[model samples]
Target: MSETDTLRDNRDRGGPAQPLVLAQNLTKHFPIRSGLLNRQTATVHAVDGVSFAVHKGETLGIVGESGCGKSTTARLLIGLIELDDGTIVFDGDALGSAISLRDMRKSVQMVFQDSYASLNPRLTIEETIAFGPKVQGLADPLGRARDLLGKVGLDPNRFAHRYPHELSGGQRQRVNIARALAMSPRLVILDEAVSALDKSVEAQVLNLLCDLKDEFGLTYVFISHDLNVVRFISDRVLVMYLGEVVEVGPVEAIYGKQAHPYTASLFSAMPSMDPDNRTMEPPLSGDPPNPVNPPSGCRFHTRCRFAEDVCSGAKPALATFGNHPDHLAACHMHDPASGHSLAGAEASA
Candidate 1:
């Protein structure tokens, strides 16, 4: 069977019919050098020991603070950046070990932030969308581009002829999304895709993404700092802090009943419509420690309210707790034997 047919089959069966994307112990570290000889200094652990799987037709939202390594993880997954250690498996093929990632580019595409900058100013909309297909030698490239433009809610007869400068912020974003689809990729990484758009426009674009997913059977690795947006678009949410996944599970569980203190802190920061719920505590103070010298153990121990001696000295393993079997978190608070219980502590407070 052709590659496209195989991909469709996999999607129909809920994955590579199998696992389309698997990231195992993925890590990225940039070494700091000093002096003329440029000896190896400290390393920035941008993405350390993060693992997850994205089945076909699923949107996996990766949420974290600005320096928490969300974008770095996205780049590592798509092979845009070199990983210091880990395995990236795409459609059963290991990308990290492969000689070149260029061959996988068509199958995996990215929609970057800053739509204005991502699109070539000199190229017209049609030229921009057709770039991928032409590069891949796809037959009927223009036809595909036009179809994609319409799919993204842009009229080929109109906007496709215009330059990026002529379109609104929303329009530019649509073109960016269309360009990712132009390659007919099985996996699409949206790195802060709508973070730059206005609220109303962001909703519209998100709706458009949902529609496109159903229509094209796409799997997405959506990276964003906007927790509400992530909750809306993702089937599962992965919460990261200081280069590690602190929690991951279904969206409802992570947002509604956050098990980890860090996840709960993130949810409390979400803008709520209920005025009564507006009394949530202020955001956690103190900036995340430098990645080059991250806190030992849980990494969040320094800021965590429930942190204890064990927290600073020994790292906690990810564990499933309470009612949600799918819900997983890495924190000392959830440890049964730790003699630390949020329920008891909250009551005393």
Candidate 2:
């Protein structure tokens, strides 16, 4: 069986299929305020009605350009920031009184991009990893911390007493990963956790993550600007554009088809290794529109090559693109009733 099949199998493991984390119509807008009293001026649409699920034991990779609300989405998932709208259901329970934010956090943890800033300068590595379990009143926090350190390939005796400043970038990241796992979280939201390390170090860390996932039976929502890395680690790929999910499907399906125009452009922009296959023109033109005043209909209409009048008039719903129910795209081209020249039964069918 292929790697994709393996991922799908693991995702479909055990009894009835259910997402470990299910988010619906998630929205968050940062209100801009100015002047003496800090009066409201404009609202930056950080994440507008974004929704997706992290299946049990599957890594759902989120990919997009900078400032596309990737980190914000991660934060929203772990409840680091309160959602302006929408509901989060984790492992079958609602995120309010049913599960409780505090309880949810115990099962879900996040690893940020900045390795140095993420760890406390004051705390020793062992102290840092043990902190969460200590707070939870778990049995033998230090023992757990040492075991975690060993699992992450760090020598407990040598590195456990060291501070964040004492270790290298890769070592620091491993420590961060260990710290995140200290709570014995079932789902981990990794927001560019490997972006800071060098290529060699990155590969090592990525392998470590995969090995750890298998050992722990953990679910991951991996957010990264690195398309290659996303492709490497994801079971399903979620493509984001200016705070909205343009497309989401199985990793192989997405990398093969790229049904959404935005997703196509993103893949096109990836730098090729071969000199013969060089990119002549830009895959996507211009920067994303101001979130405060996005386009009337499709936010990507300004840069989309196949955009039609309908794209600027009607907001496309996130619907199944073709025969595959799991593969969905938010594009007028996929909707037969959208009235775009390329949208119809014949076009999509």
Candidate 3:
């Protein structure tokens, strides 16, 4: 089946067009301290002015290499880590004004990659899932946990009393998914949630996730290095490089016509089933720059194939590219005024 047919239609959900989660100018820098007194040293630019939105009932996929801040961005979204500088708006209310951090957390939950570590070995399957609801003082947390277990394809009768070590990797991840759903959260940040599973098991979990999203009316922020998986599950795709969002657009648009050089290169690296259409040469070369001391202007300029003098000097703001609807890219090639020679006014507009 086509992605359009499989994914839920979230364009009109019987309300205002406002995004369910709005993040603007989100920046996070980790201080590197050393010496006897732990003096402040250089900062790791973990996330630099990253911004995007998660619409209600839509799965937003974030794809980037290691140290690109995908996990850090996930932490910031759900308040796992305090933001150095940024504003998060959840459900049309500014965080500090109408909603407290604690309150926002109840509406958001995260599922980490290491399912075994995420759960307490002491807690049984049922107890692990019930813990979140219990903290909220919800009545019948155990009952809710059992129901979620069934929804996630784990027969509660069989798995409820088992420990984390007794279950397979796939089963453990299912328990993690059930636990995330325990809070009845509107948004769930899944940080590499399925990357560790085998192929057949991964497909099962992916389908389970889609089923749960439809049944519970949930939104997801799926972060992973697997391009094929991201394309399969996401409604919109956001491309990041060196802690910056280089491009974001509908899933089909990103795969069909990638505007940024890094994005095109990333997609080109995806493994294909067709032997005749295999990638002849590597699309990307050279290691990514260090986050502590990144390049000037565009962080991607150093590795970008289409890099020019202007690209190394002027930072390109994320803007609409060409006539593609809702497509945005942070590259001089997409901005006419940036004077990269390849830019055009229509794309910049």
Q: Which candidate's TM-score is highest?
A: 2
- Residue range 1-349, candidate 2, lDDT tens digits: 1332454454442334787888999999999999999999989898999989888889999998887888889999999999999999987888995789998898888898899999999999999999999999998999999999999999999999999999999999999999998887778899999999999999999999999998877889999989899999999999988889999999998888888999999988889888998889999777777778777788889889988888999888888865667999999987777888887643545
**C-alpha RMSD for every candidate:** 3.2, 4.4, 4.5
lDDT of 3 at 1: 15
**Predictions ranked by lDDT, top down?**
2, 3, 1
Model 1 scores worst on lDDT over the 10 consecutive residues at 340-349
| Stretches > 4 Å off in candidate 1 | 1-7, 10-17, 96-100, 275-277, 337-349
* TM-score, predicted candidate 3 vs. hidden true structure: 0.93
TM-score of each: 0.91, 0.94, 0.93
Alpha-carbon lDDT, every model: 0.84, 0.88, 0.88
The better candidate by lDDT, 1 or 2, is: 2
User: For model 3, how does the per-residue alpha-carbon lDDT over 145-256 read when each residue is reduced to its tens digit?
Assistant: 9988998998999999999999999999999999988887778999999999999999999999999888877889999999999999999999999899999999998888
Tens digits of per-residue lDDT for model 1, 79-110: 77888988887767777455248867767889
Clashes of 3: 1
Error of 3 at 148 (Å): 0.9
C-alpha lDDT of candidate 1 relative to the true structure: 0.84
Error of 2 at 92 (Å): 1.0
